[model samples]
Target chain A: MRMTDRPSNEEGALAPWFAAGREAAPLPSGEFMARMEALALESQPAPRAAPAAPARQSRGPGRLLARLRAMGGWPALAGLTAACAMGLWIGAAAPEAAVDWVATATQEQGLSGLDPASGFDYAMLGL
Target chain B: MPYDAMTDTSDEQLLAAYAAGAPGAARALTARLGPLAFGHAFRMLRDRAEAEDVAQEALLRLWRAAPGWREGEAKVSTWLYKVVSNLCIDRMRRRRGGFAALEDVAEPADPAPSAAARLQERSRAEALEGALAALPDRQKQAVVLRHLEGLTNPEIAAIMDIGVRAVESLTARGRKALEGLLAPRRADLGYEDD
Candidate 1:
């Protein structure tokens, strides 16, 4: 019979050879293990250097004042005030605020002479 | 397995302890992974002398990597496997023609019928080793791991850093190629004895 006709397990004559190969195989032991461990340890990346500590400057009234000014100078105060005003304008222009303001304005001044409510809201007309 | 000096805690655990400055953990890990690692190196290197050197270098790498080995990331075996495979690949490239895979290089052909058959068989097997050595790097590795070392596809894949499907393909191809290579000599290997 052709070798292909024999199933792998039925290749009985070859079994002993296979078994011998398996049996004679070496096990992981002794000097071999030590050598592998050494190789493994060698492959590790080197440790990083510790970061340098930040330089310390003397702290007193002068330094404190300087830090405060850096944080909140006149330009910063002006920018903050402008930001707050813009926030107020944005808040007033919100749908809810717009609705309220329009209602109050319409009540105070009839539809003829009206303060333009930020933008038109047809929801006020129940549309 | 009995948790003896031979085989105890896992390599990962030992590495963790070693990272934490447990002085003995390195030796423990060395004992555990040593044989398989050396065998792997030997298989690729095909030279006992070079295999031994590579194995030593590989373990030294493990020792160096130990201190910074982050906890709970990758298994120690997985890490070692990749390192060893890469090292073997590099060594194989650097010294391509240095070693032959088989221990028994050229057994004498027997003069007597009974003695001759045995000697011829040994020589045939040794010659097959040269053919096995001639297989491509990945195919050789797959064959060695799957058949000789008895590693499963997943283990081989993890060591190879490839998908399981790829490992299967490599092993299947390797086996089929080996069978083809060895088929004509089947009777000589005593396959037809029965």
Candidate 2:
């Protein structure tokens, strides 16, 4: 800011004219002030919360979402869902041969047979 | 802050308060700057209606800019000066009548005791305005901001987006041009009476 503090004697003889100009400087009318005040108030940015995140429901729609995209989207998700349901159904009602083999193979190892869904059978049988 | 209490606040603080939706902050801002902006525009554009539009537009922009307004980066008045000047220049460039529009300018009559002196003062002012209007846009802006508006060179530099030396040069040239234009009418405008 190594500049002069103010404009120098450039006005000189023109000083009187400049003085008149300043004296004659326009005064705004009441209508203008009111209009400006209203505009200022109207244009104020309201105190608002940060914008609502579009993913408000899901906290981290990040890596999992990217993984879903990589796995071929909703169709792949549907396929995966169907596979899970089938796996649960088959595990509950597996072939008795498989259960027998598990019992025989694990007897020496002192492990019991896998007997998932046996409770449901007992409840149905009333024994 | 309340409207009354904001009288002593800096323009930046007032603007921040307005941005935060503080009650009466907007009114405070308008009250503080409305006349400053309007006077500059009126002197630049001459027509009261056009001046009002430019002033309103600049203040409106200031309001919109309030939220992101960085303190210490620039003064609010400087920003308004820049905006108002540019808007007036734009209007001036679009219209083809030169300073013939001076006829449409509104001059408030002085309440001086001597009617003759008042008329003479008005004539001096009008002569000055006519000379000012004849100047190139940059020169007129520099001169007005310097002599008439009484802004410092640094403030004028910020407002004009130019360097201090450049502001100095423009005002110098403008003042010279004005002197030459108004020289012949010195006695006619009652400067001799002074």
Interface Cα root-mean-square deviation for all models:
7.1, 2.0
The estimated TM-scores of all candidates read 0.55, 0.69
- DockQ-derived CAPRI band for the predicted complex in model 2: acceptable
Cα lDDT tens digits, model 2, B1-194, are 37756567898888888899887888888888999999999999888899988998888888878888988989999999999999998998898455443344345444565687777777788888988888889999999999998888989999998998999899989988888888888887777777
Model 2 local distance difference test score: 0.83
Model 1 TM-score is 0.55
> lDDT score, residue B157, model 2?
92
Please list the residue runs of candidate 2 whose C-alpha ends up more than 4 Å from where it truly belongs after superposition: A1-4, A48-127, B97-114
Best by DockQ: 2
**True interface contacts retained by model 2:** 0.88
Give Cα distance to truth, residue A48, candidate 1, Å.
Answer: 18
Output per-candidate TM-scores for chain A, rounded to 2 decimals.
Answer: 0.31, 0.34
